[model samples]
Target: MLSDTIAAISTALGEAAISVLRVSGPQALQVAAQAFKLPPKLTPRMAHLVHAMDGEGNTFDHGLLLHFQGPASYTGEDIIEFHGHGGVLVTQRLLERLLACGARAAEPGEFTQRAFLNGKMDLTQAEAVMDLIHAQSTLALRAANEQLGGAVGRVAQAMQQEIIPVLAHIEAYIDFPEEDISPETGAALLLRLDAVLGRAQKLISTSEQGRILRHGARTVISGEPNVGKSSLLNLLLGFERAIVSPMAGTTRDTIEEIIQVHGIPLRLVDTAGLRESTDDIERVGIQRTERELERADLVIEVVDASQPPSGVHRLSLPPAVASRRILVLNKPELGIHPGWSSEPAAIPLSCVTESGIEQLRDAIRAVIATAGPLAADHPIAINARHKAAFERCAARITAARAALQSAEAPEFIALEIREALQALGDVIGQVDVEQILDVIFSTFCIGK
Candidate 1:
């Protein structure tokens, strides 16, 4: 419905078999046809061989041209695509001619934004388009794909359906107090609200895992010096990403590598040995290591399996580390002994011998799976906006539940329900305007 026409180079700016120039709007075809000289038998919506020309009929490039008539294209309006030879100059000149023909350059994610504005997709699905494009792992791709397919939309819609009926029932009672509606009607409404809220809770739980998959889990491998932290990191990465040496101070700084365990991305951070140090540089490295452990979602606290039960037997973890710590008893080839049992919060392994690596991988996967799968065909909320909306909705639900528990007035519960409904609507763009739209679309790349 936008009055302006937009165009951009749709493909990545690099060498390829061909590059695409995308034009969308009411004047998309008209703008494109001005520079493209079509063949004799070619018609609209048909692919044709055309010479891309400049304003003075200077041939820029020869390419394939295809037209999509209004209302059936990606933007729900006329769209034109030019598949030209991939070259920086060629692509730029072709785009220039399109602009000279009155097409304006696209804003960041303006194409998808246009599609959203034209009712082709909602905000969640539109955002998912970007998520899918940037998904780093299989789990992330699955979650984003489900969201882009309107899985979350169906669930939200169903929840709204249930809520609307309850709201109607309550209003009916208020409208006709003489009717046979009992106070039990309020109880029934509360039950329905509970069910919907349960679903919301389940979805919220998956947000952690979805976020981990989207952003990758920060897992720090920490222990006192010479505990094979670097070796373990290399083994997990299945590559010599970290320098392994017999020297205790080989890795005096934090090193990071991305590794996938069962398709779950974990940003493995190998930090300097956690210990008291006299050297200034090593002290700074130790501080960085401590900082990494502080922010880690999961920590692998490595212990020397050869040592007896003593002060080092206890998990030497920073107070800031999360409670879910993995205790790893390294150097298992030295033999697991009674002393190993004395040490708590550990998983025994031999990084050099590759013993218990699979177990280690499974343990990481188990921790990730604890967050649970996202809702069925439900759009997993990924954007902060959607998360905020859900937060507000959750707050309203909490307030309503508290009202029910306190035997408060039914009107208060009804008000909370209305607030929850409106919050849910914002996620799907049913109740958004220019500012919210701007925030969402601004995250996208040009020609997305």
Candidate 2:
């Protein structure tokens, strides 16, 4: 039912060997025909070699023109693809020619949005499309692929299937009050609700790990002055990105770099030495260090192995930091004391000599692998929007449980269950309105 043609440059705007201009809609082929001065007698759904020209018939670039028929194309509509030399002016001219020929400029993610609206993909799959494109690591790519294959949607659908029958039973009782759909029927619904709740709870628990994979983990390096925090950062990254000097407080600000540790993305942050300082600049650095630690997913508490852990320290952090820290005993070359063993299973190493780097990498890998892969049958909630929706749905389910336990009327229980189902529908894109679709698609790049 789409009426107008849409066009956009699919590749990134920069110097490249080639750029693909994509067109989708009923007039996709016609728009390409107007731009490409090909010989007569060429049919639709065929690639034609010709000179692509502007509206004035001035030759721009010679390339191949491909046509796709409706219902069989990417957007589930007629489409055209122009493969031409990459040039900013050249691509702009071609798009302008098409726009003048009844084609409209595609909005950000308009193509994919069309595909979703045209029944080519559901909301979950559309979101996965972007996740796959922006994947920072192999683990993230794998999770996106799994969701694109409908793992998340299938789980939501299964939950809906379970709830539908119970709802139908309630409605049947409401319609026939004399029928023996008694307290036992309500008990059965409660049992079914518990089962669904268990499944949703499991998905919700994966949110933290899923988020870590989708958006790389934030790991910060923190320790008192002269503890080799900068050295450890350089060692973990396998490059001297941070300044390493003999002077204390060399790194006066936070330094960040993204690196792969066992195919998982880790956003490694190196902050200034965490210590009490009277110098104005050093004090500002210390304050920033505290804020970073508060937001860290993991903290590498580097202690100088040459020195023993003393009862009193300049940078005494909150107890929460201690609980979340993985102690790194730097400067093993200088030798460690027996008292260092009390510092939470420290990894002894010499960052200058790159000692124990592999062991440290392995430890980090173990932490992320805790929620590696859900079972083939269990679905994951990797998207933040879906996670929020599931949380709301879980709350409604909890309320429904209470209602059934208190022997509430069938109508009240049905309403609560319906509310839960609607929330799940929103997660899978079943309840998305035009406005929500606009927001989601607008976040995507035009070509995507």
- Against the true structure, whose lDDT is highest? 2
TM-score of 1: 0.86
Looking at model 1, residue 194 earns an lDDT score of 88
Error of 2 at 342 (Å): 2.1
**TM-score quality measure for candidate 2:** 0.89
Instruction: Please give, for residues 13-94, the per-residue lDDT of candidate 1 as tens digits.
Output: 9878899999999888678779888666556678788899888887879989988877887888888899999998899888
TM-score of each: 0.86, 0.89
Residue 229 in model 2: lDDT: 89
Q: What ranges in model 1 sit over 4 Å off?
A: 40-46, 171-184, 313-315, 318-323, 334-338, 343-346, 374-383, 401-411, 431-448
lDDT of 2 at 134: 85
lDDT to native, each model: 0.77, 0.78
